[model samples]
Target: GSRGSRGSRGSRGSRGSRGSRGSRGSRGSRRSVGHVGRVCQAGPTPSAKASSRASSRVDRGLSQ
Candidate 1:
């Protein structure tokens, strides 16, 4: 006479838990600029040519 007393006690302990996590996105922006300038102000003058000619004459005399 005990046929329907053990059918409702095995259906309340089978539930699983769930986990939730979030992710964040980050970005970086950087820029750099460099500038270099150079100026030259030295050249050969007429005096340099005259000195070179005199040296050449002296060398010719010595060789003679």
Candidate 2:
């Protein structure tokens, strides 16, 4: 009865998209920030450091 009354939109639409978008947005922001930081700190071995930092941030993002 509840599902029928809700028309299949309430459960699927609200929960799925919100959680996915929210997590994706946070991870995207963190990755972009890390990239910008690496660019600003360009010097010797910037790629090495940036890659490691970016992976770490991704791990943290998934954990969150």
Candidate 3:
């Protein structure tokens, strides 16, 4: 009987807390941070770069 009581208490303690304890008990089940997905930072395609470079040459004198 004592072991059963203790086992139930232990299960209750860990059942819904998600690891955090005491004062943070209320929000313990909540996830604080999550990542959506990876981000790609590859530069513009070759054609895009060529067009930008061409335009830059045409505007080089005006930028000064």
Identify the candidate with maximal lDDT: 2
List, residue by residue over 9-64, the lDDT tens digit for candidate 3: 67755542323332233332132211111211343345444654554444443332
- Tens digits of per-residue lDDT for model 1 on 15-39? 1100100010011001101111111
When summed lDDT is taken over every stretch of 10 residues in candidate 2, the lowest stretch is: 55-64
The residue ranges of model 1 lying beyond 4 angstroms of the native Cα positions read 1-44
Provide C-alpha RMSD values for all models, in order: 42.1, 8.8, 25.3
Ranking by lDDT: 2, 3, 1
How far out, in Å, is residue 48 in model 2?
Answer: 25
Q: Which of the numbered candidates is closest to the native, going by highest TM-score?
A: 2
lDDT of 2 by residue, 1-64 (tens): 8868686657655554566556665776587677666676665256546655665566456544
How far in Å is the alpha carbon of 36 misplaced in model 3?
A: 20
Candidate 1 is scored at a TM of 0.31
The TM-score values for the models, in the order shown, are 0.31, 0.42, 0.27
Evaluate model 3: give its TM-score. Answer: 0.27
Considering TM-score, which of the candidate structures 2 and 3 is the better prediction for this target? Answer: 2
User: Which runs of model 3 end up more than 4 angstroms from their true locations?
Assistant: 19-64
lDDT of each: 0.27, 0.61, 0.41
lDDT of 2 at 29: 59
RMSD of 2: 8.8
Candidate 1 lDDT? 0.27
